[model samples]
Target chain A: MAAPPPAAAATTRTGALTVGLSPYTARTSAFRRAQICRHRLPTLRCRRAQPLTAAASSSPVFHGECFVVGENIDTDQIIPAEHLTLVPSKADEYRKLGSFAFSGLPSAAYPTPFVAPGEESSRYAVIVGGPNFGCGSSREHAPVALGAAGARAVVAESYARIFFRNSVATGEVYPLELAEAGAWKECKTGDIVTVDIGKAVMINHTSGKEYKLKPIGDAGPVVEAGGIFAYARKTGMIASKASA
Target chain B: MTMTEKILARASERASLEPGENVWVDVDVLMTHDVCGPGTIGIFKKEFGEDAKVWDREKVVIIPDHYIFTSDERANRNVDILRDFCMEQKIKYFYDIKDLSDFKANPDYKGVCHVALAQEGHCRPGEVLLGTDSHTCNAGAFGQFATGIGNTDAGFVLGTGKALLKVPPTIRFVLDGEMPPYLLAKDLILQIIGEISVSGATYKSMEFVGSTIESLNMEERMTLCNMVIEAGGKNGVVPADETTFKYLEGKTSVGYEPVYSDAQARFVSDYHFDVSKLEPVVAKPHSPDNRALARECKDVKIDRVYIGSCTGGKIEDFLAAAKVFFASGKKVKVPTFLVPATQKVWMDVYGLSVPEFGGKTCSQIFEEAGCDTPASPSCGACLGGPRDTYARMNEPMVCVSTTNRNFPGRMGHKEGQIYLASPYTAAASALTGYVTDPRDFLM
Candidate 1:
C-alpha cells in the first residue's frame, strides 16, 4: 500500500488542526484526517503568547532557584485532599496546593512527609529540576501550586508533556532548556538564577553561564495579561470598555 | 505502537490519533461520591446553576463514602450540600451512610460501585462509565469501560451530560489457567501491574479475557477491574459473559442488551499470565506497582493492616480473611483493620464471629485481632481518613492494605509503607507478622 499523505496540520498551533498533502498519497481517496495538531517540537511551548507588560516590570522580577530532587512528583504532593475542604474558589485553590508541600519544606513549621524542604525554594522564580519533571497524574494543580508558591519557571532536562503544557498554558511553570539538569543538581537551593523568559535565557549565578531554555508557547499572552484570571479580567475590561 | 495504541486506534471515532492528538469522545455515564460532590456541585452551581437540569438525573450517582462519620461540621456540611443538590436535581441514586442498612437488609448491595453496580445491574459489559473518583474504574468488572475524572470534568458532565473524551486504546490481558486455590483475582492484577510497572497502562484501556476472568465470580472479577489504574490504565474490563448474565439476572431486571467483542475482534496488545502456577503477590510500601511474593516480603514491621476497599471488601474477601483467622486461631501481630466496603457486606456477609476459631463476625474477628470500628463516615482511611498514617514518624509501622495506589506519602506519611495484597494474603500476613502465602493457611 502506498504511504498516505500527511494529515491536515493546523497553522499557529493554538490547539488547531491543519492537514497537508503527502507526496506519495493517491489523489481521489480520503485520508480521514484529525485537525487537532500539536506544535513543532523542541521549541514546543504552552498555548498562549503575549508581551511583557509594564505591571510585570514593576514587580522587580522575583528571582531565586532550587532543585526538585525526585522523578514522578505527583499532584498529591503539591496539594493534599485535606486542604481542598477549606476553600471553594479556583483562585484560592492554588494557594492551598502550594502551601502543602509534602517534604523538605523550607520552613520548620511545615513538616509533611512527601515534600522536600530547603531554602524557601518555592519562593524562587526558577526551579531547576531532575528528569521526568512532574511525571504523574494530570492535575493542573501542580503547576498552579508552583506558580502560586512563586516559581516563575521550571528548568529541567525533560518534562512530562502534559505538565509542560499545563504549566505553560496557565502562564506559569515556564519550562527552560537545561540539557543537563544533573549538572545543576549540585547548585544550592538559594542560588540565584536570572531569567529572561522572553529571551529563553537563564544565567546560573553560581555557574556563571547562560543556559538556553524553551519559551512557554502561547502562554506569553496569559503572562502578558497577568495569569489566566488576570488575562480573562483584562479581556473582560477591554470588552466592556469597547462596548461602552 | 503499543497495545494501548492499537486499542485507542480501534476506539477512536477519528481515523488515527497520533501521540499528543486531542480528540473528543462521547461519554456514557458520569458518577461521583459525596467527597467530590461538594466541590463538583459547587462548580456546577457557579457555572450553570438551576440550568443544570439538562443532564439526565438518573445517569448521575452520588455516594457518600468519604467523611461520612467524622462528625466534623465541614464533613456534615459537605454531605448536606450534596443531599440537597441531589434532591433539587432529582438525582436517582443518592446513597448515604445510612443506606448501608438498606443494603444490609438486602445482601445484594455488594460493595462500592465496582461490586454494587454489578449486583444492581447498572454496569453492563462493554459499556463506558466515567466517575469522579479514580477508583470508579472498578465498574470494569462486568466488562464495562470506566474511569475517574476531576470535579471540574464531572461538573461539566453533570451540567451538559457530555464530555470531551479521547477514546483510550485497548490492552488485552489473556489469563490462561484456573486460579490456584490460594491465589485469587487480586493476585492476578497485582502480578499484572508488577510486570508492566506503575505507568505501563497509562492512558490505556485494559481488556481482561481468557479463562481466569471467565472463572471469576462477579465479586472476584470486580477486584481485578478495580485495580487497573495501578497499571496506569484508566479503565479495566472483562467482556460480559454467562457469569455476568447469571450475576445480573434479577438485580437490574432491565431488558438485557448484551454487548460483546466480535469473534474476530482485534487487540492492540496481548498479555498471557498463568493463574494456576501463581503464588500470592504483594506490593511493598510506597507504590502499588512495587511487587514481591508473599513469602518474599520481608518482615516489614507492621503498624496497621487494613483489608477493605472496592478491591478487597467483598463477601468472598471477608470469607477469605475469616478462613485464615480460623486456621491460625491467633491474634494478628498488629492492628488488623477491616472496613467492609459496604454496610451490606459488614452487617450480613461479615461482622460476625463464626465461633469455630472463636466464631467472630469477620469484623469481630478482626476486632479481636486488633481491628478498629468500621470507619464512621464510610471507607475512611482508604480515602485519606486519619487512620492511614501513624500518629508520629519513627512509629516503625508497615500497613498491609488492599487500597489502590501505595505511592509514597500516599497514606499521608512518607514513612508508612502499604503492601497491596488479596484479603487472604493480608490476613495471613497479619497473623504471622510477616508476609505469608494464603496457601499456608489453606492447610
Candidate 2:
C-alpha cells in the first residue's frame, strides 16, 4: 500500500488513532493495514503515545517499569472501600482519585508505597503479581485506581476471574497471564518489562529473559476497543454508534 | 446438563449447553448498590449517551446499602447520585433511605442487596440475576443462575437487559448422613471452602445436593450459597424444592420455570460430605479458606464479636445466636454487634408486632445479653463501614465474626484478626471472649 499524505499522517498520529495502526497508514480503512504495521514495526509508537488505542491494537505492545506484588493482592488492598467513592466526576480531580491508590495496603505489607504520594505523575506501566492476583472484591475500582495511578498493564501468574474481566471490560489495565512458572521471580521492582499482546510474550529487559503469556481469545477485540461498551458501540449493538 | 447449565441455556434461548460457550442471556433482574451504582450510571451514560434509556426500568433494582450510614460527604454523595439517576430514569424499584432523622433508626431501608433481592422475590427460579456486588451469588439459593459483574458489564446490562456469559462447568457437592445440632450451614460451607481452597472452583458452578442440603430452610440454603464466591465459584445453586416454593409463595407474582439437572448429568468434580463428621468451623484471619474447627481456635482470645452481613445477618442467624446467648445466661463478655440483614429481619428480631416472635425477639434476647444491636439494616461493618460502626476495630484486635470474608483489613484494621464462624459460634465466643465452640455453651 502507498504511504498516506503527510496531513493524513499527522491526523492519524494525533487523531482517531485506532490500535495497531502506524501513523504512515492511518487513513487506510483496510484491517490488513494493522497487520502490516504489526510485522513491520517491532517498536511501535502508537501505544506509548495513546494508551486508549492499546486495548484494541492488533499487536498491542506495552513497555514500563514493573512493580512486583505478592499473591492475593485484593481489591481492598489496592483501593479500600473508604476511598471507593473518591471517583472524580471531572478530569481535573483524577489526581485525588489516584492519590488513594494502594492506600489501603498496610505499610508493613510493602516496603514502599505502590505509588507514593505526589509520585502519581511517575509512570509505573506494569504490575507484576504472584498467583491469584486481585482475589478479593469484584470492585472495578482496583483496576480503575491502578489505571488512574499510571499503570498500563499487569503481568501475573494468575488472576481472580472477576478482576481479570473487570480489567478487560474497563480497558483500564491489560491483564497478561504469565504462562511460565516463577516467571515473575526473574524480575524485580523498577525492572523494565515489555509485553507483546499479539505474540503473547513478555520480555524482561532488566533480566534479559522472555516469558510466554496465555492466549486471551475473543476477549482481545473487546479490550482493543477500549472496553465492552466501546466494542458494542463500534459493532452497532447499541444506538449512537457514531458518537464517542 | 446440570441445573446451572439448564438455567443458562434457557436464559440464552438455547436447546443445549456447553461449557465455555459464550451466549447472550436475558437478565431477569439487575441490581446495583450505592458503592457501585454511580459508576455503573456513569458508564451507562458515557456508552449509551445522555438520552439513552435503560432497557427496562422495572427489571433493574437499586439498593443503597453499603456506605449509606456514613456521615462522610462522599459516601452520602454516592447515594444522592443514585437517587438522582433513579429519578431521571423513572425507575421505581429504588429503595431509598426512609428515615433521615436518625442514621441508626432502622429506617425504611430494604436491607443488604443480596438478602433483600431474595426476600423481595427478585431472585426467581430458572432466571438470571446479576449484581455489581460479588456476593450477588447469594441469590443462587432460589435455583437461579446469579453472579456478580463489574460496573461496565452492569452498565451494559442496564442498556441491553442482557449479558454475554460463558457457561461455566459445574461442580457437584452432596451433603449426606445425619446432621449434628451444633453444626450450622456456615460450618459446613467453611469446611467445604477449606477443602476446596480459595480458587478451587474458579469460573465454575457449585451445585449443592443430597438429603442434608434438602433439609435446610431457605435462609440456611442462602447462607450455603452466599460464600461460594469465597471459593472462586461463579455461583452456588440448589435445586428448587418445596421449601423454595414455600418461600416464594405470595412474595412474587412473576412466573418462573423450575430447573433440575438430569440424573446422569456430568459434573467436572463431585464431593460428598457427611454432616455427622462435621464440626463447628471457623475461617481464620487473612483468608476465608484458612479454616479450623472452633475447638482448634479455642485458645485465641477475641476483643469483639460481630453477627451480621448478607451472610450472617439474616433472621435465622439472629435466632441461632439468640439461642446460644439465652442458654449462656450471661452478658456478652466482649463487645458484640448484632445487625439484622434487612428491615424486615430487624423488625422480626425486635419483636415489632411479629406474631412468630411470641413477644420476645432475638434483639430483645440479645439486649438482655448486653449486645449492641445497630438499628439500621445496612451493610454495617461487613464492608468496614464508618469509623463508629458497631463492630469496627481501631487497632490490631481479634474478632470472631459471622461475616463471610476474613481477608486482611476486611473489618477496619489491617492487623485485625478476623475469624469467620456461624452465628452460634460467634455468640458463644462473645460470651467467653475467645473462640469457643458453640457446643460448649449449649452443653
Candidate 3:
C-alpha cells in the first residue's frame, strides 16, 4: 500500500484520541519514540467520539448530472416480485446483476423495461422520479433491490413516506426533494448530477439549478463513504485497537 | 405548484428542489418481508461481493408473508432460501407463519408492517419510512411520511443502509360534508382515484383535508392513506390531532404523542370533495384506475366477491362485511371468499385465540363459516387466486374485493372484469350475485 497521506495519518490520530491513546503515542508506536516525537501534535485534545460519527469511506461518491421521471411507480415495476425468485442463490451468487435485474434500464443491458420471464435490463445508479416514487407496501426489498442495481440516490418530486425512511434505514439511499418536476422534464434518465451529502445539495447539470435536501440523521459518515457498510468496516478496525 | 408540492415543501427543511437531484435524508426505520427478499440477496452479492457483511443487520427486517404456506415446490424453495439466509446473517427479526412470538415482542404488532409499525411505534410523526410494498404508506395515517420501494432498493438498504429520495409536488384532496354511513374511506378513495384516473396524481404528494377527512377514525384515515398510491400519489398525509393521538394511544409503542402540521404549514393546490353527495363508486376491470359509480354500471353481472387484503382485512372492514352478509342472510348469485391480510386477522375473525400465532383468537363469526380455508393470509392467488377467477374469456364476472388493486388478471384470468369496493359492498354483492350497492341493502 502507498504510504499513508498526512491527512490520513492525522485522521487516524484523531480517531485514536477517543479510545484513550495519548496524542504523542497515537503519532508513534510506544516502542518507536523517535518517530512519535517527530509527528506528535501539541494542540490536539482527546475526547469520546460523538455518537453516529461521520467518516470518509471507501465507497465511490456519486456526483454527476441528473434525470427525472413521473410518480407512483409501484414496487412491482421496480423489481417485480415474480423476478425475486429467479436469483441464482439465496445469497445472490451465480445471478446476473444490474439494470438487468429490472426491466427498466439503459438499452445497453437488457434493452427492454418489460421483458418476459428470464430477461433483464441495464442498471442505473440514480433514479429521479416524480412524487410518490415508492408508494406501496412495507417491503424493504424494494430499496434493497434498487441499491443492488447501483442506485445511490433517488431524486424525486417526493417519496412515499414509508419508502423514504425505509431507503435510509437500510441502504442509506439519498432521498432528495424536488418540489416540482419542471426541471426534470428538461432532464432524462442517465443524466449526471452532483450530489453533495455533506452540504445536502444537488446541482442539476441540465437546469443549472441547485436543490437542497435533508441528510440522514447522523448519516454523514455513511454518505461520505458512499454508504453505511463502508463506514462500519472503518469503525470496526478503529474499535478493535481500543479494545486491545 | 400542486398540493403534493406544498406538502413536500412544508415537510422539507432543506431548500427548494427540482426534479433530477439527489440528497440524503434521515430514515426512521427499515422494513422488509420474505416475499421478495431473494431478489435482494441476489443483487447484494453481485454488487457488494459475497464476503461483505450485511451492514446493520439489526435495522433490517425480514418476514415470510407472501407464500408462508408454500403453495408449491418452487414457492417452498423460495421460503427455504430466505430462512437459511436469515440464519446465516443472524438476522434478529424473522416471523414464520407458525412462529409469531416477534409480534408480541413488539408489544403492539397490528399485523402487517404498514399498520403494525404505526401501531407499534417504529413510525413516528413527521418522519420518513420505506418498505418494499405499496401499502407501506399506511403509516402516513399516523402523520408520518411513508411509501413503497422495490427489491433493488431493498437490496441496497440491506447491504449499505442508505437510500436516495426526491421531493415532489403536492396535490390536495379537500373533503367537505359528512362521509356516508357504511361508505368508509375505501369507497371515497376509489372515487378520488377515478376522478384523477389511475395515474392522475402520479408523482405527487396527496394531502387529504376537509371536514370529511378530519372526522375519520385512524383506521378509516389509514384506509385513505394506504390507497393514495392506488390513485398514483407518492404519499398521503393526515395532520395529527386528538383523534390521531387517541387512536395511537395504547395501541402503539409511541402512545399518546400528539403531532400535527404547523399552523402556518404551506400547501400546493387544494381541491374539494363533498362525500355526502357522492355515490357508491366502482372501478371497471383491468385497471384500479378505471372508476365509475356503482349505479352507473349496475347492469354488470358478477361471479366472485373477495373481501380481504391489507386494505380490507382490518377488524373494522371485517365487521363491515359481516354486518352486510348477516343482514342479507341469503347467499346470492356469485361465489365469495374472504382472504384476510394476515393470519392474525384470520384468527381474529374466526374466534380462535391461540397465543402462538401473534393472536390465537379467531373471529367466531368467520371461523364458523369456514373463512380460514383460503390457505394463507397474503397476496395468495389474490394476485390470481383460484376462487376469484373469471369463468370464461369475455365472460363478465364482477367481484367486490377489499384488496388494493382490481387490475385485469389480478385475481384470475385477464379477460374477466373486476370491480373494486369496500368489504361492505363485497359482502352485499356476494349475496345478490349481481352488482348491488350497500346503501340499497341498508334501506
Candidate 4:
C-alpha cells in the first residue's frame, strides 16, 4: 500500500540475523506474510510469493514501553464480550479489534488507556500485569487484541490457565511470569521495558531496574515458530497445510 | 488412578498417566458455537487447505447459540459464517436457528451449546471433549474429560482429532449430609468457590463425590460442573451412576463406559462439606468469589431478576423458581426474566406440570406471578452479547441473576451490579424487590 517500506525488502534477506527485529517489517509483514507462508500458520490459500520465512518470525527479544493492569484482569476487561462478534481471522476486524483493546478496563481505575481513543494501535509493545491476569472466558480475542494493538509480551506475577495456553497456541502475545512477586508494584504504565526470554529477565529501562522471569518452557518454541500449527509443521508433527 | 486419570489414560491409549505428564489424546468431540466457530473454521480451512475436510464430520458439533436473535450485522454475520462452514463440512450436528422471528419455526435449533450438547447426547463417560466455549466443562457431569479450549486448539482438534494436553491432578470435594430442601447445586458451588477462592483449582481437575452428589439429578450435576471454569478448573466431574445412566438412556445410540476414582486414589487436596449445614449463597458484583450469604444481604435492593444461562436455565431450575413464585402467592415487585437453556427445556417450562403448584406448569406460574414472558431459549444477558440483547443490563441497574460470574460489565453496562444467585433466590428476590432469602417463603 505505502510502497512496501524499504525495510520490507531488507527484512526478507537478513531477517534471521536481525535480533531486535527492525520495527517496520516485524510489526506488519510478519503476520501478513503468515497468510502466504507455508511454513507459518497457513492463511487462506497460502500464497507462493516472496514469503516471510520462519527465520523472520523467530525474533528472540522484545523491547518497548509497557501498559500496565492490575490483578484478576479478566478477559472481559481485556476485550469485552460485546466486541466478540469480530472474527479474529479477518485482517480488517483484527486491526479494528486492536483499537478496542482494554476498552473495558474501568476508566476510574485505569485512567491511562492501552489504546488511545480512535487510535488503531498503542504506544506500548509490552504489558505488565499483576496476578491472575487474563482470568476469565476462553476467548482468544483477549490475546489477539493485545498482539494486534502492537503488544509483544505480557510480564505478570501469574496467569490464568486458558489465557496462557491461548497466548502460546495462537502466538499472539508472549505470557511471561516474573520470578519475583509484585511486578505490579514495581512497574507502572508507560515504563520502557525489554524482555529477553533466553536470558529469563526483563529490564526496566525507565526505572533502571532488572527483574528475573520464569522460563517459557515448552511453550517458547511454539510461540517462536508462530503458533502451534507452524511449530507442528516445522517439527513434522503435522504435515504442511499447502501440501495437504 | 483417579477417575479423570483413567479417562485421560483411555483417551490417550495409555495404561496410566500421572499428573503433570503431557500426552496427546484422541478427542471424542470438538464443539464450537457462533462466538468461536468462525475463527475455528477459518483456522481449520487455513491450515488444512481451503478444500480440506474435517478429520471426522461426525465428531465436530457446531451450535449457533450466542449472539443469535440480535440485529447487529456482525453478530448475524457470525451465524451465517457458522452455517456456511457447517454446510461446507457436512457437519453432522449443526444446530441451526434460521428463524430469529420464532425459534420454534426451526426445530433443530438448540439455545445454549452446553445444555444442547448434553440433551443431544454428545457427552459420554470416559471420553474426551474439547470445545471453544469456556462452559464446555459442563459436560463433565457425565464423568468425562471435558474442558474448554481456545479457537486454535479447537481448529487443531477439528483437523487432527487430537489434542496435546497435560494431565491435571484431581482435587476431591466430598459432600455428605441429609437433604437440604433450601439449598441447590448453585449454592453448593458458590460455597465451594468462596472457600477456595476463584483460582483455587486453576490447572487442576475437580472430582465431586460423596452421598450428597449421588442424591442429585443429572441437571443438578451439570449445574455443579458448569461453573468449574469460574474457579479456573480444567474440568469438574461427578461419577456416572443410575442418575446418569437413566438420563442417557434413549438419548444416544453410542455405548459408553464410566470410570471411577479408586479407593486409594491420590488427590492434590481434599475438602469435605456437610450439605445440610450449608446456607444459600450469592457471589457479589465484580467477582464470582466475592461470596455472601443470601440472608445476610437481605437489605440490598435489586431492580430485576434474570433466571437463565447454562448454569441455571434447566427445566428443574425453572421448576425451582416456580415453586418459590407459587409459594409467595404474590406478583413480582420487580421485572423478572426467564430464559431456558435449550428448546427442550423451553418446552418443558410450558409442558411439564409443577407438582408443588397444584399441577401447574412453570409458564403458568410465571404468568400468575406477573413476570415477563419467557423469551426464546438462549444465553440471554448471561454474558450480554450485543447492546440490544434481551434483558441485558443496559442501565447499570442492580439485578439478581441465576448465572455464573458477575464480573464487571459481564451482563452489559460496566457499572451494572449483578448478584449471582440460585433460581430460588432469584424468584424470592423478585417478589420483594430486594435480595431476599428463599427460606422466608419456603419455610
Q: Give the candidate number with the greatest lDDT.
A: 4
Candidate 1 TM-score, C-alpha based? 0.74
List ranges where model 1 is wrong by over 4 Å.
A1-64, A87-94, A103-121, A126-144, A151-188, A191-244, B1-21, B49-51, B97-119, B253-268, B351-377, B386-396
Worst 10 residues of 1 chain B by lDDT: B387-396
Prediction 3 global C-alpha lDDT? 0.56
> Can you give the DockQ of every candidate in the order shown?
0.10, 0.39, 0.12, 0.48
Per-residue lDDT of B187-245 in model 3, one digit per residue for the tens?
88888887886566656678788899889887788888888887767788887777876
Model 1 achieves a DockQ score of 0.10
Q: What shift in Å separates residue B350 of candidate 4 from its native position after superposition?
A: 1.1
Q: Which stretches of candidate 3 lie over 4 Å from their true place?
A: A1-84, A88-244, B1-22, B44-58, B88-92, B98-112, B251-259, B352-375, B385-398
How well is each residue in B1-443 modelled by candidate 2, as lDDT tens digits? Answer: 99999998999889998889999999989999988898888778866778989999999999998876667787788889998999999996888884555644534478789999988889899999999998999989999999989998998899889898989999999999877889889998999999998888889999999999999999999999999999989999999999999999988999999999999898999999989988899999888899898999989999999889999999889988988888887999998888788888877787643344355667777888999865577888876866765567768899988999888788888788899999999999999999999999887
Chain B TM-score list for all models = 0.86, 0.97, 0.83, 0.99
Q: How would you encode candidate 1's per-residue C-alpha lDDT over B1-443 as one tens digit per residue?
A: 33333233434455455544555554555776655677677556644544547388877777766555454566667767877887788887666544432434433223465555554567865455677666777887776667777665666577666655545667788898877778878899999989987667766678888887888888888888888766767678777788888887777644534455555555667899878888889988656767899888655666667777777877778778877877777777766766676766667445455666555666666556665555421454654533332221223357788767565555555555678888888888888787777777786
**Model 2 pairs whose backbones collide:** A55-A223, A55-A224, A56-A224
Q: Given candidate 4, what's the lDDT at residue B129?
A: 90
- lDDT per model vs. reference: 0.59, 0.80, 0.56, 0.86
User: Highest DockQ: which candidate?
Assistant: 4
Q: What DockQ results for candidate 4?
A: 0.48
Runs in model 2 deviating more than 4 A are: A1-57, A88-95, A235-244, B103-108, B352-359
Error of 4 at B383 (Å): 0.6
